[model samples]
Target: MPEVKSQVDPSDASPFTRVRQLAQRAGLDGFLLALLGAILLAYLWPHFGSDDGPLPLNQIANYGVSIIFFFYGLRLSPEKLKAGLSNWRLHLVVQTTTFLVFPLLLIAARPFFDTGNQKLLWLGGFYLAALPSTVSSSVVMVSIAGGNLPAAIFNASISSLLGVFVTPIWMALYLPNGGHNSSLWGTIGNLALQVLLPVVVGVLLHRWLSAWAKRYDKQTRYLDQSIILLIVYTSFCESFYRGIFQGYQLTSILLLGVLLLALFFGVYAWILLVSKVLGFEKGDTITALFCGSKKSLVQGTVMSKVLFPDARLAGIVLLPLMMYHALQILIASIIAQAIGRRAAPEVPVPEPVAGT
Candidate 1:
């Protein structure tokens, strides 16, 4: 047996290695694919509901963010609060970027949106800017990069919590097309019921549910992704059904894509520069830069009804969110990996010292 052994190349062998390789291979971004799928599903949504009734599928899509948040609470431990308290500076930078700088950038770019369609596009960007930082992906990036897991988790969760309030306030200040006449208190109730309530329930039961959450986390992630894709498809489908693109052209979308890419990279670069100037180490800077720049799709969707009740304008409001989410994931994933490689040699002591 030893004499007859055949050698396997390191890159060509092992299931774990192969799976990671496959994941790393370039393809259409998963979020983009999910969005496209959601659009197709949305197109078919109205058919399932009624002649003039809400599509059951679209209704299901509406709960996507809540479901995601519930699963989030189930997974996150109460320990996160303690962790959040420990890294005040990192949390400070991330929160400032998410709640302050991002929105400011969106506001500054408003003057350039002159075209009738351009305003909608700019509003979309602004809506995206108002949303909070993401939780899962940012933590994943930080963990993979060997940056700081506790800090990432803390900042990400706090950002989501903060977004529940900040997103609406920013909309009141900057969102242009006007849909704010709805009962603000009722909207708050809707947010509490749909988003925060489930999370609160899950957090309350986390002691009993932690093991279950850990076991089913992968399944829950799939569910989250599937629901989001459904939302994207259904939303776009409604646009198609309503002839939403009657005047909107491919050129406009293309231009918007370029602009979105610029916005993501520009904010990311700014964060990196700021973190460096502030004297953060490489790992903390990497974590800060990623955590600061990304926006939350879940937050945007859940908050939009309150922020922009005019369903006519809601889709445009979501455009920037959709674009930014996709771009940030792809760009940040690459940058995180590169940073991980560069910082590998300098990573702190993997195992703690003996006897404390």
Candidate 2:
């Protein structure tokens, strides 16, 4: 006789189990959930990192950012980056989108906002466009989506380096009289010492430490996210204390959110079209889509201190970027999971013998 078999009913599963299954399916994992919590905490306790606050959160965040990039550089394989560089077409597309397409889009939208406050807000949007793709999140999302990881790493790293010069030139076009005293060379020097030096050190040590770095990849990711949260908290704190957010009306804020969403999807769609036109493989396409769509909050926050000079307007300038950062993560997480699922190989089950 055939062996008896039992099947569990879906209805019999506990509510907690069902909810967990749904969340897993939807990619709403703990990290994404914690991001929402981080925003709430920032809103509730923005004063902690204010200009006259009890803590030195900004200084701590600056150090943390360097460490984050150091680990990032440690994980990157020099051989992989060199090999990936041969894919010049992919590199051209991703970089062009980051440095050219994004800024052009925002510039085209300038005529829509003519008033003083509107122009400031528009400048915030333009600033977001001028920035480079994020390092950690861009690579993370592309890997999660089964993209060309090496190319993703190469493009993201180069984008950050390029932004050191490119972003300032873009800002100078419109912010000529913003009263910032620092020269562009001074800004570059600051970035080279704080951001570039640590990266070079990590790269030099990568051969000896690569295995250990891979071993603790998950922990490093958590550390990266923690540092980002710290930065967000301090940035929002400065904004909250200065009433920077209050300068905008509710309708305008909502519209800005909508515009950011549109910008994300618009770039994503353009990348998809371009990748198809170039006849890219699935992995390369995924890398291009993710890297092209993201803007770097890390670069933005660091550059803001140097570029804005004025503490009050710096917070306001950061607002659009903050919103874009959160939205990109949320949207990209969902999309990456969907692509991962689609790319996943189907497991073949064994067939039963005739007389088992």
Candidate 3:
């Protein structure tokens, strides 16, 4: 007689288990949080419009981001940077793609965008290209895939440092000077303050507080993501409030979303292939593909205040940045799963051992 096995059904007994199973099945509880935040924004926005009612939650969220960045600074360590510098070549490739190759692609695509809602969207795409690679997400993805975490931390930090200069140069070359946009010097100052300053402070205190950072990593991480999701919701709210999305047909925006998605994944696939061709091991390849393809939403928004100013196009300028941020997280999470499985192969058992 064959033995029988029973499987547990989460739905039958506990509601808690059922929700957990559902979230796992759909993948990305963070994304679900982000989506929920967006829904809340849509619901509460109308009430917040009046002067007496209350301050807009979006503005509250932006303030939260500033605080988040300060804590982000507190958490970064010099050790991570030093270790990443040891494998400078791997970091170099990722930085080159993020700063150099990506900008070239965006520039090349400009002619195609010359007609039809292309100009604004092109600026958005260029903004996406110019921004730095992500730190937290890159490290998270690498860790999840069982890849090199220290290298991810190093490369991601270095990329952020490089963006302080590189992103402005790209913007100056691509965006014609408007009367309101900040000069290059002002942009640099803003970058120094908003990005470099906090990170530097974090590094300076690393020796004293690194252990605490490790212990509280999970809590800080949740706050970090919540802040980003808030930023996204607020950005979209501003765009929606300003009638930016309304000006364009719903179908057209949907089409652009698909196009942007293709562009994102296309570059991701290309990098994965290139990393393999360049003789990177599976772990390094995973790092390169993810770190290379990501753009930093936090940097873009912080810069937008100085670069674009309190202008009508601010929200529109950031539309591509928003789309790219969400897309990278969703797509990379999926790819990381696949790469992790491949990298950790299952060995076959010898059948003769049983007979012996």
Enumerate residue pairs that collide in model 2. Answer: none
lDDT tens digits by residue: candidate 1, 272-325:
888888898877887898788887776666566446645556666677777676
Kindly list the per-residue Cα lDDT of model 3 for residues 1-356, writing each as its tens digit: 99989887655768876775555433435454564566357445723422223666555654564565566667766666676677766787898889988888888778877754668878888888888888777777776676777778888877877877889878876564664444777666766776567767776777788788889987876766666655555555555555555556677567667867987877787787788778888678778887888887766766665566443456668877766666666677766656665666452211100000
Alpha-carbon deviation at 95 in model 3, angstroms: 0.8
Model 1 clashing residue pairs (backbone): 38-232, 38-233, 38-234, 39-232, 39-233, 42-233, 42-234, 43-237
Say which candidate scores most in TM-score: 1
Provide the lDDT at 27 for model 3.
Answer: 44
Cα lDDT tens digits for candidate 2, 1-356:
99989998978999998996666444455654565566567668877776678988777877886786688678767887787778899999999999999999999999999987788789899999999998777887787788998898899888877887788878777773636435666556666776778778888999999899999988987787777667656766777777767767989988999999999999999999999999999999999999999998767866675567555566668778877876787688778867776877352211110000
C-alpha lDDT score of every prediction, in listed order: 0.70, 0.78, 0.68
* Pairs of colliding residues, candidate 3: none
List where candidate 3 sits over 4 angstroms from the true fold: 1-7, 10-27, 39-66, 345-356
Two-way lDDT contest, 2 vs 3, winner: 2
RMSD of 1: 5.8
Better of 1 and 3 by lDDT: 1
